[model samples]
Target: MKHLVILGAGTSGTMMVNHLIGKLPKKEWKITIVDQYKTHYYQPGFLFLPFDIYTTQQVKKDGRKFIPKEANYIQKKIELILPKENLVKLEGGEELPYDILIVATGTNIAPDEIEGMDGPGWYKDIFDFYTYQGAKALRNKLREWEGGKLVVHITEMPIKCPIAPLEFVFLADSYFKNKGMRDSVDITFVTPLSGAFTKPKATKALHYLLEEKNITEITDFNIERVDYENKKIVDYADTEVEYDLLVTVPTNMGDALLERSEMGDELNHIPTNKATLQTLDHENIFAIGDATNLPTSKAGSVAHFEAEILTENILHYIKGEPLKEEFDGHANCFIETGNGKALLIDFNYTHEPVEGTFPFPGVGPLQLLKESRANHMGKMAFKWVYWNMLLKGTHIPFVSANMSTKGKHFEKMES
Candidate 1:
């Protein structure tokens, strides 16, 4: 029997595993999924964790609960990936062979990548909300502390949930106001981008929102290193921004095993065919979600959309037929913008997010690029959809693998 091996059981891996079940006969193929961790986190919920919108109990769970019966789930560390031999070396020196491989290894926070970022002030005066532990630590710090200069910074780009740091600052503004310290705590949103976001249009909207909230925005500040001793982040041009509390999103990279395997790019992301979701290096391998070096938002919705197209391609690959390039990097994300409101953005590799109605043209229950309470509810309701429907490989109603232009209005396309 041929074997299908999947790496990582995070959002992307979990969904991909569910997509493969029952499609391949259990008698003919054995599916195995490996992950280092037992518990799965709702990573997007990490944004709310520090602010008490979501408790740890709500975001954390055993990943095995959602796993399918047809696959063998292995809870072990990946020590190495010998891609040339199509084998994965586990911690105990055992090797697992695969006829087909799916890489969903996902990305990680590398605090050490920046000088002095992981030093003395980490989790004391400085913290991250990306990981469960970091968010929880930051939560504890936020509770007892009196606020001063609060700097919300991003070390680099391509981090998960690009809007989250901004969300944190907005939430912090609201949080401090509720605590009656709004006037005292100085809030600054520091980013490396020339503007608020990667897309210029959305940047304009978010820039206005930041101004409305009375939060400061520091643009084009490329962080070169952190001076933990002085509690400052210095830019490449030697501009220094000091912070009493540093809430940072560190540099993000793919799994170290990918680097060890000699099968990934500079950031350790696997080189993937953007449309096919197949690895450029090997025909027997496929990549999905944050593991791919796709020029798209590494969000959960994108992974779900990519999975639909990749599932079809996998079947074609097994049948020895030419695969269709249907995946268009479709992604839609709802950014929670405090005070029970949020904004949604929908775009693909070629299109930037434009102002329009979503899911239904001119009759959307949800609006795109506009802030509303409905968008917040849409964002919250996704958690249920994720657990009950998405991870089980069910397609979201009205959502397709390609970018839907029916409800969206684009002045022009980029890329």
Candidate 2:
């Protein structure tokens, strides 16, 4: 039997395995999935943890529950990938040979990459909501604190859920106002980008919301180091932003195993064909999610979209057929804009987020580029969809992997 090995049973890997289970005959192929952790996190829930909207218990599930019975689930850390030999080494020195390899190891936040970011003030005066531990610690910190200078900072770009930092600041504004401490707290959004968001139209809309909520924006600031003792962050240009509490999104990088194996780019992301999701160097290996160096938002939705195309490409590869170059960097996100309201944006590689209704042009229950209570409800309802449908490899109706311009209105924003 030909062996198929998948690394990191996260969203992409889990979905891909499930998709392959139905397509690949059990008699002809054997599938194996490897991951160190057994518990899978609803990563998007991490964004709401700091505000007490979600608890640690609400976002976790057994990883084995989603992996199909036909696939062998090995709970172990990967040591290296020897692509030339078609073999993967595990932590205990066991080598697994595979006819095909899939890498969905995903990216992680590296707070240690930044000086003093995780020093004396870590989980105390400074914290991040990227991980469960950090999010829970921040929750505790926010509970007892009367407010002061609260700064939400991003160290670099290409972070998973790129819009989450902005959402955090927006939620914080509403959280402080609800606690009757709006005037006592000062919120500032410090980003390396020139605007509130990467897309021009969405940036204009989100920047307006930041202004409306009285949040300060410090743009184009590249971080040098964190002066934890002084309760300040210093940029490369020597500009300092002081804070009583700092919510930082650190430098994000792919699995260190990729770097050790010398199979990844400078940031340790697998070099991939932008259109096909195939690793540029190896025909037998493919990558998806944040693991690949795709010029797209490293969000769960993007992974879901990429899986639709990558699964088809994998099947084509197995059949000795020409692979379809169909992935278009399709990504959509719901921006939580406080006070029971949110906004959604849908776009792809060639188009910026435009104004329109989602799923349907004139009859959407969810609006795009505009804030509404319905959008917030849709965002909240997504958690249920994620657990019951997305991970199960079930197709979500009306949401195609390819971006549709049918419902989108292409128009310039009023800057």
Candidate 3:
């Protein structure tokens, strides 16, 4: 039987298993997925865990639960990817050969990339909500804390869920206000970018929210090191931002397996065809989600969309057909602005997020670029959708893999 091996059992890999299991002929092929962890985290929920909005139990579950019984699941650390030999070496030195390989081994926080960031202050005064441990620790810290300078920071660009740091401060604003300590906590958002976000329109809208929430913004601050001794962060320009509590999203890089194989870019992200989801170096290998160096948001929504497109391309490859250049960098994200409000942004490679109705043109139960209680409800409801529909590879109704621009008000580009 032909073997198809998938690296990583996270959102993207799990969805691919679900999507292709029914499509690929079972009599001729077998599928196997590998990962080191037993628990699968609802990463987006990590954003809410610190403020007591979501409990530790609510954010994680058995990784095996979502994976189908028919597909082989291996719980072990990946040692290396021998792409030339079409073999994967596990930690115990066992090798698995494959006819096709799909890489969904996503990116992770690299706090050690910055000096002193992961030293004495880590998990004491410095914390990151990107992991379950960090989120839970920050929760414990926030519970008893009287509050002081709370700095929400981003180390660099292309981090997973670029909007999450902003969301953290917004929730911190609401969290403190609810506790009657809004006046006691001082929140500052520090980023290496020139603005609150990468896109101009979204940045303008988010910048307004930062001002409205009275959260300070320190832009273009490229961090050099963390002065754990002085309780401050220093940038390359010698600028310093002091803080009592520092919650940072450190530099995100892909799995070390890519680095071991020498098949990845500087950040360890595989160079992939942005449109076809195929790895540039190998025709039989494919990549999706945060594993690829795609110029798009590294969010779950983008993974969901890419999974759909990649599935089609994989099928074409099996039949010795030309792969479809269909994926357009589509991404949908809900920006939680706290106080029971959020803003939804939908865009693709050629489009910036504009004010538009989603799913249905000019007729949305959800509004784009506008904060409302309804959007917040939609954001909350997504957790249920993620567990039930998204990972299962069930296509969301009314939402296509490609972005729709019919109802959007786009500004005219200067030709």
Candidate 4:
């Protein structure tokens, strides 16, 4: 019997397990999943944590609860992945050999990477709402925050759900207004990017939103270090901004096991064929979710799209056929603009976000690049879809693996 070993029973790993369990012949391939963690976090729920919209208990479940009974699930930490030897080393000194290896190790916050970031003011004056624990802590701190200079920061790039910082700002505005401290609080967005977002058109739209919301932006501000005792963030240019409270998105990197194996890139992300989700060095090895160095956003939607394409590729590889380069870097994400409304953006590798209607061209249940109650509901409704449909490998009816350019309003290009 052939052995298929999967690492990290997170969203992508769990989905792949469900996908293969029912698809592959049980007598030919036996699947085994390994993860150190017991509880799985509803990561998107972290965005709502500061607002008291989601509790700690609501966002957590045993990781084993999601794993299918058809496969062998092991709760253990990975010490190293020996791709050349086709084996994964467990911290307990046991090795699991595999015919096909799928790495879904995912990314994690590395606050200690930044100087003074995890120092004196770690979770007190400076709090990160990225993790379940961090978000819950922020909720407690926000409850008594009397309003001062609130710094919304991004230490570096390639964080999971890139738009989360902006969403945090929008929600914070609404949060303070509800507390009657809108005027008393000064909100400043600090980022390394020269504009509001990755794309220029989206930046224009976002810059307007910032002005409209009276939120200030400090562009190209590459944060060099956090002065914990002084309550300030200093950039390389000697520029500094002090904050009464710093809500920051810290550095995100892949697992330490990647470093030990020497199978990862500079940042510890696996070198993968972006479209195929296959490892560069090994044909039988594949990577998914935040673990891969794909140009697309490290998001759940990206994982969903990648998984669909990867499933096809894996089946092809097993049959000794040419793997399909089908993944188009398709990603869709919602930006919470507050007041019970959110903006949706959809695009692929060659295309950036443009004005458009989604799902349906003329009459969308969810609009694109524009804020609406319907889109907001779509954002909220995804929580249900994530737990029920997405992770279960059930196909989403309205959403396809590829991006749709129909109903999108594109600006005329100039030569």
* Residue-wise C-alpha lDDT for candidate 3, range 1-415, written one tens digit per residue: 9999999999999999999989999999999999999999999999999999988888999989999999999999999998899999999888999999999999988999999999999999999999999999999999998989999999998899999999999999999999999999999999999999988899999999999999999999999999999999999999999999999999999998899999999999999999999999998999999999999999999999999999999999999999999999899999999999999998888888889887688998889999989899999999999999999999999999998888888764332
Summed backbone clashes in each candidate are: 0, 0, 0, 0
Candidate 4 per-residue lDDT, tens place, 1-415, comes to 9999999998899999988888888899999999999998889999998898778877888777678999999999999888889999998799999999999999989999888998989889899988888999899999998999999999888889888999999999999998888999999999999988877777887888999999999999988899988899999999999999999999998988899999888888999998888999999999999999988899999998888888888889889999988898888998899989999998777788878788888778777788899889889999989888998899999789998878888653332
lDDT, candidate 1, equals 0.90
Q: Model 4's lDDT to the true fold? A: 0.90
Residues 26-60, candidate 2: write the lDDT tens digits.
89999999999999999999989888998888889
lDDT of 1 by residue, 29-77 (tens): 8999999899999998898889888899988888999998768999999
Candidate 3 stretches with Cα past 4 Å from truth are 412-415
Mark the regions of model 1 whose C-alpha exceeds 4 Å error after superposition.
none
Better candidate number, 1 or 3, judged by lDDT: 3
Candidates in order, TM-scores: namely: 0.98, 0.98, 0.99, 0.98
Best by lDDT: 3
